[model samples]
Target: MFDLSQFIFFVIGCLATFALVCLLFPHLFTRQKKFYPKRVITAFESRMFTRLKDAFPHHHILAQVAFSALITHDQIKMRNQFNRKVTDFVVLDREYNVVAIIELDDPSHIGKEQEDAERDAMLIAAGYTVIRYTQIPSIRQLQRDIR
Candidate 1:
């Protein structure tokens, strides 16, 4: 029985089901907004970043840079267990080669000493200098260290 009425009812039913699903889960059907505002660096880190920029005008002072950005994905597993760790500041030369990794030591970092040591070891093994500071170092000291 090739009923045109049955075909019409089937199409209507499918459309109704789809409309119901979309109404139930509007987010799934709607276009999502992706971009959001975020702070690149904390207040304390911002001050340090400013000092770093002033001190090393020629060098690149990257704040809140990710470890994954610096190292290849394959190298990450070879280096250490921590995944996607970020350094407080990564100083790079004019050629974009890493010059040094600077970590700001505060009271919050006390419990994570072992993790910090492992990260430092990995960075040093990769031939980059690692400097930890509780307080901001003088511009002269930074110049001496980088040199």
Candidate 2:
């Protein structure tokens, strides 16, 4: 016999099961977020960024520039190589032409020399300048390197 109390308990049990499934497998019921806000630069990069602005007062300084923005290749493979690569900082002339690509190499770069050189060679081959610095250079040094 189907009693009212038994029917109410069955409904509550079904609701509890549904809630448990939703909680355990949220993706089944909710869309997952794919992206989030992030810092554009690190503390070291931020310090160098301030120096870039001061050293090149008349020029434009852009941080975290995608390599794709400054270089292009007809080959899909070549494009893919740089498609996700980002330069630390890009210095531009008053006319907005890229004067130099600066990569501030911290201790993290100790074992990445070969990789960095390969990336630099790719940029150099494309007729762009790539400058690497282990530490913040003197303003005069920055001027000398780019000029």
Candidate 3:
């Protein structure tokens, strides 16, 4: 029933309506994403955190701490290597001084000996005690190793 001009007008009207709807509710035309909080530490790390807390009742145990938080280098290149790398657990004395940089070597760390050593070496060079644990240590072992 529509001639060429009428058909063109109808199409234009439909497009305008669609454009208006999109402008009013742009989210309807786009993908909706609902973000939720994710766990900062892994399940194994969570277990370690709990154990560390139990082991050192008077000390503070900080998990997933970046090296940059504790150490800084004058060279940008040197900083870049470890600035963003995270240490598993940073044991702190009652006065909040860093006691040691602790790394839990679960199955995931099997092939990363050289890399781990390098990371440890960096901390060691900074005069920090770096301890890597193959498994969760008993309270006595933790106390002994930390001392």
TM-score of each: 0.68, 0.79, 0.74
Q: Candidate 1 — which residues are off by over 4 angstroms?
A: 1-36, 73-80
How far residue 39's Cα lies from its native spot in candidate 2, in Å, is 0.8
2 against 3, candidate with superior lDDT = 2
TM-score order, best first, reads: 2, 3, 1
Candidate 1 lDDT (Cα, 0 to 1)? 0.83
Q: After superposition, how far is residue 92 of candidate 2 from its true place, in Å?
A: 0.6
Give Cα-based local distance difference scores for all models.
0.83, 0.93, 0.91
lDDT of 2 by residue, 1-147 (tens): 879999999999999999999999988997867788899999999999999999999999999999888889999988998889888999999999989999999999999999999889888998899999999998889989988
TM-score of 1: 0.68
Q: Comparing candidate 1 with candidate 3, which one achieves the higher lDDT? A: 3
Q: lDDT of candidate 2?
A: 0.93
lDDT of 1 by residue, 29-143 (tens): 7798678899987787888888888889999998877776666536745635545678899998899988899998878888899989988887776678899988888888878
State candidate 2's TM-score. Answer: 0.79
Tens digit per residue, CA lDDT, model 3, 1-147: 759999999999999999999999998988878789988898888888998899888999999899998888999999999978999999999999999889988898888899999999999998999999888888889889997
Least lDDT summed over 10 consecutive residues: which range in candidate 1?
A: 73-82
Clashes of 3: 0
The numbered model that scores best in lDDT is 2
